[model samples]
Target: EAGVTQFPSHSVIEKGQTVTLRCDPISGHDNLYWYRRVMGKEIKFLLHFVKESKQDESGMPNNRFLAERTGGTYSTLKVQPAELEDSGVYFCASSQRGLARSYNSPLHFGNGTRLTVT
Candidate 1:
């Protein structure tokens, strides 16, 4: 019954530092997703996980970003050698399998992990 949850709500780091963010989805949810907003740009999807497998990763910006949802549970997003351009709020969301697969239901999102790379 819990909603999505993210850890280390805010992070500040110098450029090139490594930062890892985490997300925990609600129980019984099989769809997990990551999205982010850089500066004042619109939020964009980063990746999606259906159970333990990655369903889509088309929106991930580049190789510096990595995302994972091991064992179909909590998820993590890591940015290596972070850049100033990467500073933004990273949001995690989840939805039920049936609703998600058909795109019928709205996603439930976490508060977001804000990272500032300077």
Candidate 2:
């Protein structure tokens, strides 16, 4: 059983550049989510995916950010024309879809990828 894995581990980019972060969830997990914490803010949910479908994207800040889970295996979060406010630690997490509403599955989180936008 593998835990979540995020690529690049860290990234530094100038404003207006594009950066794509990748996450590979644990095998057999069907729920994948994206989160982030900016310097002065608490970690916030960016999006959720149940398998290959976007479950909730209400937390996304703007049009410059995009998240996708294609084929229900791995996911990618892309930030285009990155801004200073986008600098933060990006986290990816996964959990098995529970059989019942009362059953809680703990989420396995990847070591976040730190994005520095200068």
Candidate 3:
């Protein structure tokens, strides 16, 4: 079984530009999550998606960020008019359906997409 994969390991863009990050989680995994660490801060959750529905999005910074999981297969995070504070390492993780809410369930993470906004 392959692990999660994120495209464009590194991206550099202007402050007002748009950037989109893609994540392909492991096959058969039903729970997908987006997380990020900005400016050396600890990783923080951005959102959670179960299948094609969003279960949580409390950690999302603002309205400029959008997350989608179409067909419950792959996921995407688009940041329109990216801000300097949005620069960070965005991580994608996934686990089995019901296991996600359990403490013992292991989440497989991608290599992460590093975004730099200048």
Candidate 4:
């Protein structure tokens, strides 16, 4: 199985600009999630997408952020008007439906997309 993949390993954008991060999960996986760790903060959950449906997005930071799992395949997380506080490592993860329910089958993570907003 292909592990999760993220694009642009790192990005730098000025404040007020928009940026889009991409994630490609393992084939046949039905669960995808986005998370991040800003500066001194612990890793935080951003959202969960089960197929094309956003199962939960309660962790979204603000209205400027948007996430989608188009066609239930690859997913994308976009941040518009990026803020200085948005600088951080964004991670993507996925698991098979069978493994998703297993606490032992922890999320497989991508290296992460590090964003820097100035």
Which residue window of length 10 is worst by lDDT in model 4?
97-106
Task: At residue 34, give the lDDT of candidate 1.
Answer: 96
Tens digit per residue, CA lDDT, model 2, 1-118: 7789999899999999999999999998999999998888899999999999999999999999999899999999999989999999999999989667323888899999999999
Q: What C-alpha RMSD separates each model from the true structure? A: 1.5, 1.2, 1.6, 1.6
- Residue-level lDDT tens digits of model 4 in 40-94: 8999999999899999999999999999999999999999989999999999999
The prediction achieving the highest TM-score against the true structure is 2
State, as a TM-score between 0 and 1, how close model 1 is to the true structure. 0.94
Assess candidate 3 and give its lDDT.
Answer: 0.95
What's the lDDT for all of these models? 0.92, 0.94, 0.95, 0.92
Kindly list the per-residue Cα lDDT of model 1 for residues 1-89, writing each as its tens digit. 67789999999999999999999999888999999988779999899999999999999999999998889999999999899899999
Worst 10 residues of 2 by lDDT: 98-107
- Clashing residue pairs for model 4: none
Alpha-carbon lDDT of model 2: 0.94
What lDDT, from 0 to 1, does candidate 1 have?
Answer: 0.92
TM for every model, in the order presented, reads: 0.94, 0.95, 0.94, 0.93
For model 1 the local lDDT of residue 43 reads 93
Off by over 4 Å in 3: 99-103
Cα error, candidate 1, residue 101 (Å): 3.5
TM-score winner between candidates 2 and 4: 2
Q: Evaluate model 4: give its lDDT.
A: 0.92
